[model samples]
Target: MTPSAPPPFSTLIRTASQQQHTEAESSTFMGDLLGGRLGVEAYARYTEQLWFVYRALEEGARALVDDPVAGPFIRPELMRTGALARDLAHLRGEGWRDTAVPLPATSAYADRVTQCARSWPAGYVAHHYTRYLGDLSGGQIIRDRAERTWGFTRRGDGVRFYVFEEIPNPAAFKRSYRELLDGVRVDEVERRRVVEECGRAFALNTAVFRELGEEFPLSA
Candidate 1:
């Protein structure tokens, strides 16, 4: 009898981190924001936190642009800093940068991404996958919510961060991204580490949402 083939690495990672992913998705802040229970200020504040996190994620990408483990995932089209900045400006005017500040959870999240990008390129893949793939997937729900709730123009300035103008086909891009993950040149030990890091990334994201929930509790 032939033994069954093991699941692909992408499947392993996703299955391993499924709980954390669900928890992040089900966080109160996200639920409130997506449900339109929160006001536009809450949404703007959330976008501000994203700006800091994406800056860290993208700023570190330049150093890893040639790394064997992380390089393949560093597609320029996935960059979000400029889009985040545009969203902030539209939400908070030209001086948004002056007022933009990271929540404590956000600072920690960004710092972790920076650390992984600088020290462990393979681990950086966990963060890259957790974030950009998520943006291409569930993040669209956010773009739709923002448009409907806040009356932002469809894929316009306020929600530009969620729009992937470069990737005409997000579903296709995500499939290719999963292929990269499955083919990553890591041994079993490092693959497990990357999987663990994916969980950590989701936990960190949930922390941000938890803090935002505290900051913008639902009204009676």
Candidate 2:
């Protein structure tokens, strides 16, 4: 069964907080390493140049800015994949790539997330990736979009963020999600906190998207 959606407010904060955490997760591993957000070599490319790969990654990261459904369920990688694909269609369609949005300097949180993902002891990276894949495989719209658009199939030249093998059907994977949540019993207060955080996550994303939309605009 799906984890009971926490209360409205707790979910809000959790979702919002989680969004930042997710972006930080990507940046921690992908950003500084790639040229995108002051990281290393990029995993993918954009604008037919290696430099554009950073932009493509950011474009991919920015997709979760306003997603409400992100926090309640525990698979962010999956969430990002779906959102990234649609944004690609939008960002690529018009000339939004050239738009200027301030890329904030790295923060403490981002730094930590990177450390966690990078120093992921043993199977952490693989575990994290599995969680993300679980979210994407659900017959949900986000996964569907990513499966079609967000290119993660190739290797070598880019597309390093995904784990293409070892996982089974998304539906089967997701069936266990509810059980995962059910095991983590929280009180009314903690539950409220989670819900609130989720909402915050959505609000933050909304603001981010609203601003970007204004600068970029979906279409005419």
Candidate 3:
């Protein structure tokens, strides 16, 4: 009998984390915010939280740019810090940074990304994959809703964080991204650790959403 082909690493990681991914997507805060039931203030607050998380993700990334596992995945075009800053400025004005604060969950989430990026590059890739890919995918839905619900211009400052100006074809970019994942240089044990980290990334995300939901409860 012929040996069966092993599953692609990208497929393995995604399939392993499907439940956590679903739970994060199904969070009540995301539901209301995406459903248009929540106000623009809620969206702005969410954006503020994102700024903190992305800053942590990107800031620590500079040190890892040379790592074989994490370097290939650190495409400049995928950086969200600048775009997130623009969105926050547009939403809350010039002094937005002064008042913006990460909830406990958001801080914890950013800390994890920092920890991974600093000590474990492969694990950093897991957080990187979880975030940027999700932004490229489900995050677009957010841009559309924000534009329609709050009148932000298409790809304008308010929703620019979701826009990948450098990546003209998101589908193609995603394919290449998955290819990189499939080719990542790691042993089976490390691969399983990366998959577990992906689940953890989504859980951290859900915690942020839970806090947001608490802060911005739906109107009766």
Candidate 4:
């Protein structure tokens, strides 16, 4: 009998990192934040942390615009820096940038995105896939929760980060993105490295959550 074909790259990535992904989601901070135990202040602080990360990711994408391996994934619609800034401004007032600071874990996460985007295209894709796809998928639930819980206007100034004005069909876009991952040329070793980097991305995200949990401990 013939051997089975290898799994698709997207499936490989999901299967390889499933446990870590769950851990990141189930972290104390995420648990509190998602369960509505935390207030809008906590959510705003989380957005501030995201600003540092997306800034690095988008700036790095600017440098990689010409890369043969990375260029195809450089989607203008996926860029979140501007939306994040607007969200922060609405949440924190005009001087949000002047006062916002990255938590230590956030700095490290941003640094890793910068490093990979500059050096390893596949690794950069690992982070890009982790974040933007999550934003498209699970992030929709987050947007709904924030809106209902905090009374933010629907798809208005406050929750602009979750609104994708460019992409009419997020599900189709995600499928096309996964197909691109499957088509990208990479050897066995590089594929393994990319999968591993995806795990690291989740870990870094969990660290940020852990720090947030510490800062905003749950009440009795």
Candidate 5:
């Protein structure tokens, strides 16, 4: 009898995160936000929350840029903090930095990212993969909806975070990203830990969506 092959790390992370991923995508807030049922202010609030999370993620990326396991995936084209800053400024005006505030869930999420960046490179990769890959994928849908509903030009001032202007082909970029995930070298225990962190990342995202639902209330 042949032995079973070990699952790829990408598969492990995806499978473990499926439940939370489904819940986060299916959240009422997400539905309304993407469906164009929410106002521009709600989207701006979401953007504000992203700034906090990305600040932590990018800062962590700088710290782990030389780590063997994490360094390979740190592509400059994937960085969005500058784009996010531009979007926030366009949405909230020049005083955006002073006025922006992270949702409680966002603050917690940032804290976790900081902790992982400082102590565990593989752990940092989990959060990094969760946010950036998701941004390159489903995040585009949100960007389109925001532009259509709010009158922001495609890849223009307010939607710059999703633009990926530096990346000529998003599909190819994503394929390369998945390949990197598949190739990351880690032991079974560490791989499993990273998978769990991916699930936690999704849960953190869901909490933010739930809080948004409380504030926006799908009916409104």
Candidate 6:
């Protein structure tokens, strides 16, 4: 009667996270670009950006918290557990900048990913985004960074953005995804291109990290 959940998205996340290129470059990035060598300045800048990202997630969660469709998938109590929102408030009062010079590469990745969303069949796109954004991998990064490094939390609101309904398996979720994709009736070429473009979007993100090691990546 019901379809099964898909395999965990960890396959993709892990593959991306563990790139030797990304890792090696990140070491340089932290030192050269991020000021890992400089120590406090880089750390301060990193914290500033981290706060902005968490704040963005909080805003997104707040916007959809009461949505008829998205509400059930999200649990608000998690927000306070991480308390990112409260932390952001504290940081802002402390003079944090939401948009500092040389903005994060995530902005570029987000734009391209948005285009992929547009070209995708609405059903499949919904599945892709909801599942990708709502689960273990990306959320795990957010949680780890927030607690260990950022210190931008006083409650569970930040955590709310990371929580997902973890069933024993993901078959049910996959079924939902397949049904949505199947129903969308997208053209083969356009759908394929969208998938490819999504990969490009990911690469853009990778590039951003890679560029962090650059002495000066952008001219403007």
- TM-score of model 2 (CA atoms): 0.37
lDDT, candidate 3, 7-84, per-residue tens: 999999889988888898888998898889988899999999999999999997899989999999999999999999
Against the true structure, candidate 4 reaches a TM-score of 0.97
Q: After superposition, how far is residue 27 of candidate 2 from its true place, in Å?
A: 24
Q: Could you tell me the TM-score of candidate 1?
A: 0.98
Pairs of colliding residues, candidate 5: none
lDDT of each: 0.93, 0.34, 0.93, 0.91, 0.90, 0.41
Which of 1 and 4 is ahead in TM-score?
1
Q: Residue by residue across 155-197, what tens digits does model 5's lDDT show?
A: 8999999989888888898888888999888888888889888
Residue-level error in angstroms, candidate 2, position 140: 6.7
Each model's TM-score, in the order given? Answer: 0.98, 0.37, 0.98, 0.97, 0.96, 0.45
Which 10 consecutive positions of candidate 2 have the poorest summed lDDT? 39-48
Q: Which residues of candidate 6, in runs, are more than 4 Å off?
A: 1-87, 90-107, 110-131, 149-183, 213-220
Model 1: how far residue 112 lies from native, Å: 0.4
Give the root-mean-square deviation of each candidate in angstroms: 1.1, 13.1, 1.0, 1.1, 1.2, 8.3
Off by over 4 Å in 3: none
lDDT of 3: 0.93
Query: lDDT by residue for model 6 over 9-41, one digit each (tens)?
Result: 333333433453244334544434333233334
**1 or 6, greater by TM-score:** 1
Error of 5 at 80 (Å): 0.6
